[model samples]
Target: MTISNDLFTRAQELIPGGVNSPVRAFRSVGGAPFFTKKAEGATLTTADDKELIDFVCTWGPAIHGHNHPVIRDAIAEALNNGTSFGTPNPYEVEMAELIIKMVPSVEKVRMVNSGTEATMTAIRLARGYTKRNKIIKFAGCYHGHVDSLLIAAGSGALTLGKPDSAGIPEKLAEETIVLPFNDLSKVEEAFSNFGDQIAGIILEPFPANVGLIFPTDGYLQGLRDLCTKHGSVLIFDEVMTGFRVSAGGVQEHVGITPDITTLGKIIGGGLPVGALGGKAEIMDHLAPLGPVYQAGTLSGNPLAMAAGIASLKLLLEGDAYSRLDKMGKQIASAIASTASEIGLPLQVPQVGSMFCVYFSEKRVDTLDDATATDTDRFNKYFHTCLEKGVYLPPSKYEANFISTAHEQGAIDRASEILCETLREL
Candidate 1:
């Protein structure tokens, strides 16, 4: 057997599904996952010694690309200081200040261990601030593995949520209101009926988990206005899109301010980190300041802070975002052209460095549309591209990221491979 296959066999004996995360199992793409030996500059060197052009970008953390020297150097310097200290560190303060400067709505911020904690704390803070229990979340917008947030829609459009996973309590699910994404009338109706009861509305402004789906025109602004009218907090889960989308994220891009923003991925600079930040008035409700209690021992680890600082500093360098956007457009346009040439219906939604391919004629503005895409054809194309040395996000439902390391040549190469793969299909 191959080294990766052997590793998988050994891993399955110790780790559930032979992977730490479910999606890493490659279940959606129908194959055993490959183990990476090393990664650098938009490429993963597999344990079996093959190198592939990486589009997964560590699921959105490797914006500067894998193992960037700046981030690595920062981590090394932090190592001299010590990895973690129980007491607060200067790096924590600096990181918090940086976040406030980057994201405008965040007048105050709290560090957490993962996206789940960031979202969980945001939900609790909202409930405490509004004195309401119910929360509304758009369908297919993943906020993390938090129990309350791990819910799906019930039978009807406006029905109370049901647990998407087995371990989540049904009572917690009951307090969650599930609504179809991008449907403003349904949001208005829900607010009309249960506005007073809703503590908050949480969503990924540009939902990436279900595919890179964008909001309908004015849909996000409408949610913001409705939440304002109802006195419910609006939380944007920017775990995937936060720094990857822009230095300020979708809120900054669209000019729609949310009461609370949940961030992860790039903020940690490839380490484990998450943050919850928003207006100080609402954030003050959290402990040491207010009644709501949330804390983490490694919330602001020095190493994570150093890596983040370096990563953000690199992002601040000249024309990084412009380069990322240009690369994304290049790949997206090439894929569209190839699809047209092949007489195949395709939808490639892209913004900045994030993009996803949907083999469907319909525009995927909502989760329903995303789910209806031609996943079978996508699966075939995915493996074909992989065999040809382009590593995509194994699942068709996930978004593929273009990093700063994805220079024009690399982007063109990946695009050519993708087009050739598509044509073969």
Candidate 2:
């Protein structure tokens, strides 16, 4: 009956902590992670035969929900043609064009396998083009596990990143200056101290990795202006927010364009795809054009491209974003009202379809505020929701997602469960 325990017993012998990813171990919550067998629409059928209303949505890729027929059919059609060619394909060009059209700031784009690769390539391209060595990243804004960007990694690595990973050299960490999120004074000070040597400033414009923290008014524009003044590249790591926040991502929503933007999640349509895009002049710095070398055998894989095209097509079909905004507001309001009724200290930060429920009395505006949350209370809430057949992101530091598949019924049920859970807690 305990499927997660059995799977963990077997997986630990093969994979580290019984998961390819660290957070799946359920370490923060102190429980066995459910082994998912199948998923359809907004629900995940676990190996134990439990059907849960999935809110994590595979950590943001299943924006249209799991096993979407259009995306699946596209992948199947691609599989019939061939798998990998390790060469150019028409789908690659189509995917690139779709990205260029959808994201306003991505004038040119290069594909890779994961967000880590996209960010790594973006940083490399900035360094190559600017001929500078230093980079700036904000605390608790995770841009994947890339060595140079690990100074204050969030999500799964947040608790263990005090020393910035075991293998990353101190010299590499020294090159990265980690500052507070949403703090313009710290950003200005960093630039003032090392503006000449800094190649780029990279951050998650919304800071979703440590929960959904929004930028202060004019904060993103300030970054753009500062980067322009200092002759440094501004890279918005929108792996989580790219397509989820709006059709054009956070950059368009905020009316500020970064020099580079890293995308993943919804753009890939639940596939393993990532891209870094920016001005053609800077993108040309990559290999086959300039000296910055970046290559991926599976970059622009046909199946991924097919699924992405299908997903993007579906997203472009109607006023889907307006629907997403409505859903986000509905769920956020429901949860907030319930929390207030129960006198539970909670803060729900939401943007579009992504949100995080922080078990804190104070408003969460920065990474420090996020860390101050009562994670112990969150673990209790998570287990309670899980027992009620609702699945949320396992860690308090992560965001919960809603997909097009989630209807009012699911949202209401989830809100009721959360309310009961908080009351019990």
Q: Number of the top candidate by TM-score?
A: 2
The C-alpha stretches of model 2 lying farther than 4 A from their native spots are 159-163
lDDT of 2 by residue, 1-425 (tens): 49777988999999987899888888888878989999999999999899999999999989899999999999999999999999999999999999999898888999999999999999999999999999999988999989998777899887433526789988888888899888898989998999999999999999888988888887888889999999999999999998889888998888889999999877678889999999999998898999999999999999888988898888898877777778888878888988898888989998888888998998888888988999889998899899999999888989999888888788878878877787798
| Deviation (Å) of 34 in candidate 1 | 0.5
Q: Over 4 Å off in model 1, which ranges? A: 153-163
Predictions in order: lDDT: 0.88, 0.89
Of the candidates shown, which would achieve the greatest lDDT relative to the real structure? 2
Pick out the ten consecutive residues of candidate 2 with the lowest summed lDDT.
157-166
Compose the digit string of candidate 1's lDDT tens values, residues 1-425. 99999999999999998988777888777888899999999999999999999999998989999989989999999999898998999998999989999996899999998988999999999999999999999887888777888775211111112327778788889999899998999999999899899999999999888778899889999999999999999999998899878899999999999999999889888999999999999999999999999988998999998998888888988999999999999999999999999899999999999999999998988767776778789889988898999999877678899889887788889999989888888
Candidate 2, TM-score vs. the true structure?
A: 0.98
